[model samples]
Target chain A: MKVLKGAYSGLIFLFLYAPIVVLIAFSFNGAKSRGAWGGFSFRWYESLAQNADILHALRNTLIVALLSAVVATIIGTAAALGMHHMRRGLANFMLNVTYLPVLNPDIVTGISLLILYVFIGINLGFSSLLLAHITFNIPYVILSVSPRLKGMNRHIFEAALDLGAGPVRAFFKVIVPEILPGIVNGFLLAVTLSIDDFVISFFTAGPGVSTLSITVYSMARKGIKPEINALSSIMFVVVLLLLLTVNIRAGRDIRRRAQTHVRSHSPRALSSREH
Target chain B: MSELIRLVNCVMAFDDVTVLNSINLTIKDKEFLTLLGPSGCGKTTTLRIIGGFEVPTSGDVFFDNVRINDVPPYRRRVNTVFQRYALFPHLNVFENVAFGLRVAKVPKADIERRVRESLDLVGLRGYDKRASHQLSGGQQQRVAIARAIVNHPQVLLLDEPLGALDLKLRKEMQIELKRIQQQVGITFVYVTHDQEEALTMSDTVVVMNDGVIQQIGTPVDIYNEPKNAFVADFIGESNIVPGVMHRDCEVSFAGRVFRCVDTGFAPDEPVDVVIRPEDVRLSPPEEGQLDGEVLSVTFKGVHYEMMVRARDFTWMIHSTASEPVGARVGLSVRPFDIHIMHRAEKTEAAS
Candidate 1:
């Protein structure tokens, strides 16, 4: 049974990552063709570094993702805070409304945003793409943050006020610290999703505002570019590093919280350190 | 002691249900007064009103003879040790204790000195670096107390601060709390449902029920002279039986006329008779005032608790002697042991 379970997990992992493994391996190939691996070399990477169009696309992707993630996180966290204090029924209604953007098909959101921008007489370019990314990224941020707010002790806010801190000071000193991990997680999720998005960017992004994903798609339409493989490999490693840092920090937080919970409930063992 | 805080006809109604109905109370400086009652009896509501957490629906709250109904909690010189010890989880012991001083913008040196002094008062010296979560329930409770007292408020409100500890820890903290209150020399308005804790710690005990103050007096006064059946039953174990007040110091119950140390009732008026369990003495069936069959008996460490059914009412008697089940026993009470009280107009059974 143990062997079978191990085999099953191994097969699943292989099936999931085999294609990425092949793409990464090919990025180091000297050959220009996908099927023929004429030994390993850094020729494709060297070309990818000097490719102005691809580099420009990479710059656009980073700018759009970072800017949209920041704006979306601020708006979404404020909305979540507002909704956290609402009456239960109203809060539930608003939460369901917030879920609509995440649950709706990306194509639908993209087309609707495109049509709205055209009708509103706004030019479709980098700003339009940025707006679209922010709009879609907000729901992810709110979804991540609302649970932290719910888990918070409701009395801490009142305790802060009772202890001589005003409302604004209490919010920053106590409430923000309590929910900060969730905010950071939401921001990371927004950045990842905005970078990975393609369907929405394709519709909302106008001429000359090509993101990395859109540029790859356009290059793939003509012919599979060997330099694109190197680009994807670097992007994957960057995302992997980002996720590792987040997971490590989150693990430390959970462990510290768990230790506190255990200590609070354990049998009262006085250390005899009385004055 | 002088009056430091007063609630004048304070009424708190949340939506349609009234939590406090025209509560009028005066708290004295350096007095340890406890609000004792079961849950939802408005004891907590009264404490919150004084803490500036709740605005009275239609009445005024006075602190130092100044009406502070509109004053917010931070503006009031009062702090509450919450029931759950709502210590800031992100802060260490020293920082939690120093929270109020930091917000008040006190000097850094003064804040450190006061924080250390308060921690020492709570017997938690050298624990300033420990996080709030790293402490046991008793330690957390001490931290909460230290946090509240470090501010040097004129009055400190504790909402059942020891309600979360185990029996042994609770007993220890009860004494610890009393000593801390005296050392701080601030008026402490404590709230709890435990009558024994109230009796042990408070200089004055305020018994409340159904959003109204049932009785307010010293512990001995509240115990020995309960104004009504609810106060008598709530404060301690008592067998409250109905009786007729025939004349001064005379009442009749359980098919016998008994003399009590009470008077000023209308002639032939119905009254409630309160008899403490420990005060009832056991005697021979023929020699006692009332006789009954013992239904059950259980040893309660210091005393044996026996339930005796006599006439129409069951009496709880605590004695050093044990009476077996189904045994015939006689119960006798002295005239001073029988307390007569005016029957409550709309008495609901004590919870």
Candidate 2:
């Protein structure tokens, strides 16, 4: 049974990541031919370094990702707070509206946003792309944050208020800290989503505002390039590092909280013994 | 004595259903007043109204002769130690206690001194830096108390504050709370469903049922002279026998005429006779007021609870003596121990 389980897990891993592995392997191939694997070489890495358009697109992608992540986090946190205080029916309705952009197909959202921009006579550029990314990214932030808000003990807020801190101060000193982990997780999710997006950007992004994903698509359409492999490898590594750092930080924070909880409760056990 | 807070004909309704109806109470300064009731009897609702968390419908809340009906919870000169303690998880004991001071914009040095003093008062002197989430349930409760008392509000409201603790912890905290009340000398409006807690802690006990004040008196007065069936039943364990009031100070129950100290009831008025378990005594069959067979005997740590079956009803009597099951026994109750209350109407009975 254990052997069967091991084989099943192995098959699942292959199904999930085999394409990515193949892509990475091909990127490192030193062969002149496209299909055949070659001995490992540094040609792709050098070509990737010299690519100006790819670098520009990467910079634009980073800017858009960072901007969207910040805007989404602020708006989503506020939305979460508003929803947390709202009546159940109204909150749920608002949540459903926020999630519509996420649930709808990318093509439909992209087209609708394009039409709205045209009707309003708004120019589509980096700003428009960032706005589109935020529209879709906020729902993920809200979903992530709402649960954390709900999980938090409401007594904390009441306690702060009772202690004479006004509503605003209590939100910053108590409510925000309690929900910080959720906020960080949501921010990371938004950043990842913004970075990897292509379909929405394709419709909203104007000339000279191409992102990394757009650059990758255009490059792939022309033909496979060795430099593309290096770029993909770099993107994969950066994302993996970001995920690792966030997970580690989150895990540490959880452990610290648990430790503090245990330590505080332990003194009672000691006092009982003394009594 | 000056009236610290008063609820005049206070009525609270939620979704067209009355939760608190016509609650009239005047809490005196420096009095430990408890609102006692069974679950969902609106004791908590009344406390919430006084704390300014819930506004009474069609009534007035007065604080020191000033109408406070429109006052928000933060603006009320009262603080509540919520049932769950509600200590801020993010703030340490010091910061949590000092939060109100900071919000009121007290000087930093004064805030620090007051926070330290409050923590010391709660016997948590050296643990000020510890986060509230790290504190034990009892410590969390003490922190909650410190948080409230540091502000020195006129009235401190406790909504079953010790209900979450275990028995031993609750007892310890009860004494601590009474001591804190004494030291602070503030009006305390405590709410609880536990009769023992109310009896042990409060100077005045207000027994309530279904949103109405049933009786308000000293703890001894409430326990000794409950005005109605709900008050008698809720204050403690009582054997309520359906009976008829024969005349002034006389009630007949279970084929026996009993002398009671209660009055002002019309003759032949249907009533319920209340006798606490500890008030009834067991003796030889011929030496007591009534004779019955012992249905069961339960050994409580300090007393033996004997269930005596008399006629169609069973009387629970608390005694130290062990009695064999099914043995014939005599049960007697003193006249002063017998409290008579008019029987609840059919609608009240169903509730």
Candidate 3:
């Protein structure tokens, strides 16, 4: 049974990654042909950097992801903090309202945001695309932060206030530090969603400007570009490196804490012990 | 002593569910007062009101004769030791204790001096850099006390601060806390569901249930002379029986009239009488006021608690010696042991 389950997971992983693997391999092909064996080379990677259109699209994608993620994180975190102290029924109702965007289909959200932008007669450009990304990214941030807010001890906030710190000062000093891990997780998740989104970006974006996903989708109509594969492969490697660094840091922290607790007692213990 | 804090008919409700109903209480200066009740009995809510964490729906709260109903928590000169301690996990012990001083923009040297003093007062003098999570439960509780007291607030509100500790540690901390309160000479408002904890540390125990105060008195008065059936049952082990007050120093129960040192009830009025388990003396069946067979016996370290059956009712009796099961014995209670109280409404959990 274990072998069967392992085989099932292997098949699922291969099914999910097969196309990406093929793309990465073709990016290194020596000749311009699909399905034919060609010696490996780095020509596509070399050519990708000089391609102004693809580079522009990459820049646009990076800008939208960074800005949208930051704005959405701030608004979502503030909204969660405000809603945390509200009456329970009202807070629950507001939370359910926030969940609607996350539960609704991307196509529906894309269409509605498109309609609203058009109705307002705003010009559809980089601003419109960034707004679209920000609009959809907020719900994910709220979902990530709400659990941390729920687990927090609200009395600490009151304790801070009671200790002569005003409201804003208390929030930054006490509340922020407690919920920081959740906030960072929410920001990262928002950035990931914003970077991969294409539907809303397509509907809202104007001509002459494109994000990485939009550029890739447009390239697919004629034929898949090996240069596009090269860029994605680069992105994939960067993400993997980031993950490795984060894991190593977290593991070292845990080990250090364990050593401190198990190996050495605080000075108070030794000082207070009787002969 | 003067009044340090007063709640004048404070009423609090969320939606239609009332949590505190018209509570009027005064906490005197330098006195240890405890709000004692079961979970959801509004004891914690009362503490929160005093700390200015919650505004009453329609009442006033006075702190040293000044109405503070609109005052926010930051303006109130009171600190609370939360139930969970709620120490900042990011900071070290020294930093946590020094937070209030830093917020008040105190000088660096003054903050250091006061932090050292507070830590010394809690017996954590040399441990400045220890993280909160690294400390034991008792140590963390002490840190919380130090953190609150370092500010020198006029009143310190503790909400079951020792509830998370084990029995041995909790008992030790109870004595430690009482000593600290006396040394600091601050009015301490403590809230706990543990009756024993309240009795040990409080000068005034306010027994509450279902959003209302059942009775308020010293621990001795609360135990020896409970005003209602709920207060009597909630305080300690008791055998409450239905009785009638015939007249002064006279009551009737157990199918016969008995003399009790109680009065001020209408003639032949129905009442409830409370008899503590320790007050019942047992002897041979032929030489006591009532006779009963011992149904069960369990050893309780210092004494043996036995269940005696008589008149279709079971009476719990605590004795230094044990009696064999199924042995019939006569039980006698002194007249002062029979505490008479008027009937109370069914507002608390059943015994």
Candidate 4:
């Protein structure tokens, strides 16, 4: 049974990664042909580095992702905290309202946001794309942060006030620290979502304001280039590293929390001896 | 001690559901006053009002003769050791204790010295670098206390700080808390549902029930002279039964007239008679006033607690001597141990 399970998992991994592996391999091919690998070389990577349009698209992606992630995290965290303190009925209503955007299709959100922006007479460009990303990212940030707020002891806020810190001071000193891990996790998720988004960006971006995903799509019509393959390989590695870091930090946090919980409940004689 | 804080006709309500009704209390300086009651009795609400966390719906709160109803908690000269020890999880012991001082912009050296001193006060010396989560419940409690007291607030509020500890640790912390209160010479407004804890650590015990103060007095006074049946039953194990005040010192209950020390009741007025379990002395059937068969007996470490059926009431009597179940025994209570109070409904009407 164990051998069968291991074989099954190995096959699933291969099935999932086989295409990506082929793409990565072709990124190193010296020949321009799609099928023939003349030998491993860095020619595609060198070409990708020299592509100013791709570099500009990458810069746009980073800027939008970073800016939208930060803005969404701030707005979402504040909204979650406000809802957390609301009456149960109102808080539940607010939470369901937050979930609506997340549950709605990305295409629907993109179209609606485009319509709203057009109705408001705003020009479509980097600003429109950023606004759309922020709007979609806020719900993800709220979902990630709501759990941390729920698990938190509400008394810490009152304790801060009792300890001579005003509302803003206490929020920064105690409340923010308590929910910081959640905020960072949400920000990372927002960054990934904003970078990975294509459907929304396509609908929102103007002629000159294109992210990396849109640029890749536009480049696809000109026959797929090995430079695109090299670029994708690097992006995949970066995303994989980002995911690995998030998972490792999350696992460490859970383990540390469990350890502290066990330690807190350990025998008094055992804990006192640590002194 | 001079008066430090007063709640004059304070009425607190949440969404039209009143949690505190016309609460009038005056806390004196250097006094360890405990608000003792069962859950939902408005004791915690009273503490919150005094801590400036909750504003009274329609009343005045005076701090040192100045009305502070509109003051925010951060502006008040008060601190609270929360029920679950709400220590900051991100901060270490030293930083948690120094939080108040830092917010007040105290000198760096003073903050250091004061944090160390407060940690020592809570018996957590040399634990400055320990994370809040690393400490046990007892140690966390100490950190919470240290954090609150480091500010040197004129009044400290503790909302059932030791409710989470085991019995042994709770008892030790109760004594430790009393010693700390005396050492600091600051008013402590403690809240708890445990009557024994209130009696152990408080100079004044305020027994509350149903959003109203049932009785407020010294521990001995509240215990020996409960204002009504609720206070009597809540404070300790009391065998309260209906009776009629025939005159000044005479009351009748359980088909027999008993002499009590309570007076100031109208002739033939209905009252409740309170008898403490330990106050009942057991003797031979022929040598006592009320004879009953022992129904059950259980050894309670220091005493053998027995239930005896006498007339219409089952009397709980605590004695070192064990009475076998189904055995005949007699119960006699001393005149001073028998307390009489106006009936609860009548008292409410009068109030």
Which candidate leads in TM-score? 1
In the predicted model 4, the residue pairs found to clash are none
Candidate 4: lDDT of A153?
79
| Regions of model 2 farther than 4 Å from truth | A1-50, A87-105, A115-124, A206-208, A246-275, B346-351
Model 3: pairs clashing at backbone N, Cα or C within 3 Å: none
* Interface RMSD, in order shown: 5.1, 4.6, 7.2, 4.7
Native interface contacts retained, candidate 3: 0.48
Q: What is the CAPRI rating of model 2's predicted complex?
A: acceptable
TM-score of each: 0.96, 0.90, 0.88, 0.95
Tens-digit lDDT track of model 3 for B1-351: 998898999999989999999999999999999999999999999999988888999889999899999999888889989987888877999999999999988999999999999999999988899988778777888999999999999999999887767676678899999999999999999999999999999999999998899999999999999998889999998999988899999999887788889978999988898999999999999987999999999998999999999887799999999899999999998998999998775632343
Return the TM-score for candidate 2, rounded to 2 decimals. Answer: 0.90
Q: What is the lDDT of candidate 2?
A: 0.86
User: Ranking under DockQ, best-scoring first?
Assistant: 4, 1, 2, 3
Rate residue B243 of model 4 by lDDT.
Answer: 84
Q: Put down candidate 4 lDDT per residue, B1-351, tens digits, no spaces.
A: 899999899898899799999999999999999999999999999999988888899999999999999999999999999988888999999999999999999999999999999999999999999999888899999999999999999999999888777777888999999999999989999999999999888999999988999888999999888888999999889998878999999988889888878878999998888899999999999888899999999998999999999887999999999878998888898899998887888465875
Go through the candidates in order and give each one's DockQ: 0.49, 0.43, 0.33, 0.51
Give one digit per residue, the lDDT tens place, for model 2 in B1-351.
Answer: 688888898999999999888988999999999999988889998988887777887799999999999877778788889877777676788877887888899999999899989888989989988877667788888988998999989999999987767678888989999999999899999999889999999999999888888899999999888877778888888898888998988889999898887788997988888899999998989998899999899998999998899889999888888789999888888888888887778435575
Report the candidate with higher DockQ, 1 versus 3: 1
Return the TM-scores of chain A for each candidate in numbered order.
Answer: 0.91, 0.86, 0.84, 0.92
Estimate every model's Cα lDDT from 0 to 1. 0.91, 0.86, 0.87, 0.90
Among all windows of 10 consecutive residues in model 2 chain A, the one with the lowest summed lDDT is A266-275
- Model 1 steric clash pairs: none
Compared with the true structure, the alpha-carbon lDDT of candidate 1 equals: 0.91
